[model samples]
Target: MSQVFKGCCAAFLYGVLLATSLGGLPASAGEGGLYRKAGGIEAYIGFVPAEITQGHAATQADKPMHDGVPRGHHQYHLVAAVFESDSGARISDAMVTAQVSGLALSGPRKAMDPMTIAGTTTYGAYFELPGADLYTIVLTIKRAGATKPVTLKFTYDHRNP
Candidate 1:
């Protein structure tokens, strides 16, 4: 093959490899599964079973329900962190609210508690899952210096569990 043709082919292969590698990286806005970016801020959310948050008990029946959560329902812990979109600086002053709902039932929107964990400020709240159903979680964030609130929605299907 000619030298110029060989050079072009190598460049093409390199470009393909680069593109494929980059595609695997997280997106700027929705990089991680529970990440979203809006109104110049990035938010990360995590959900954990009540057992993990409250500690494991000898039996599932021994687990206590979080305040205000009804009995016979399983509680899920929600944790969130906000960051500046451009600088990636942790944002601790933003007001965060989580609205949890399901196709069968919708709960009231509640304010999440803000706390510092391991030097990082995070917001947390507990939601109840009555049974196997599809649930929708919507987070509304109001950050300082931002005119509008950022809203992000995530869905969870607990049909099997």
Candidate 2:
């Protein structure tokens, strides 16, 4: 087989192994978290507090806030990953962005940064929450080789926090 095919197979196996080791699929799968397929690519999206992301980062350092976001605002990181739906191979070459809106608040669509954890590539962006309210997160993913972008929307309840 060709080297590219071999690589894809390896990546597929890695994804399966990782999922198994984690005990099951991500909670996002059941929580209205964005999981969709288009143009042969499957996208998985999630959001978490910036503090949680900082804790996960190997550097363990806080990220600087964007100039416009006010201090003390609740900050969150949007995380996304793409995979080949058929083969389960992870796709790292993609342009990802997200917009958040709710409670009369709307955030700019921010470009996501690619991050690798345990050999898996995930894209993320940071956005600020104005207060404890319900928010809708929209993710747009343009995967390499795909003709059109895929959009995923999900509601996040921040009222409790």
- For candidate 1, the 10 contiguous residues with the lowest summed lDDT are 51-60
Which parts of model 1 have CA positions greater than 4 angstroms off?
A: 1-32, 55-72
Candidate 2 lDDT over residue span 15-43, tens digit each: 45434533233422432435666555666
What lDDT tens digits, residue by residue, belong to model 1 across residues 20-135?
43223233564535677766777767665554443211112453323433334487767777777788777788889998888857776888866554445667677787778877
121, model 1: CA deviation in Å? 1.0
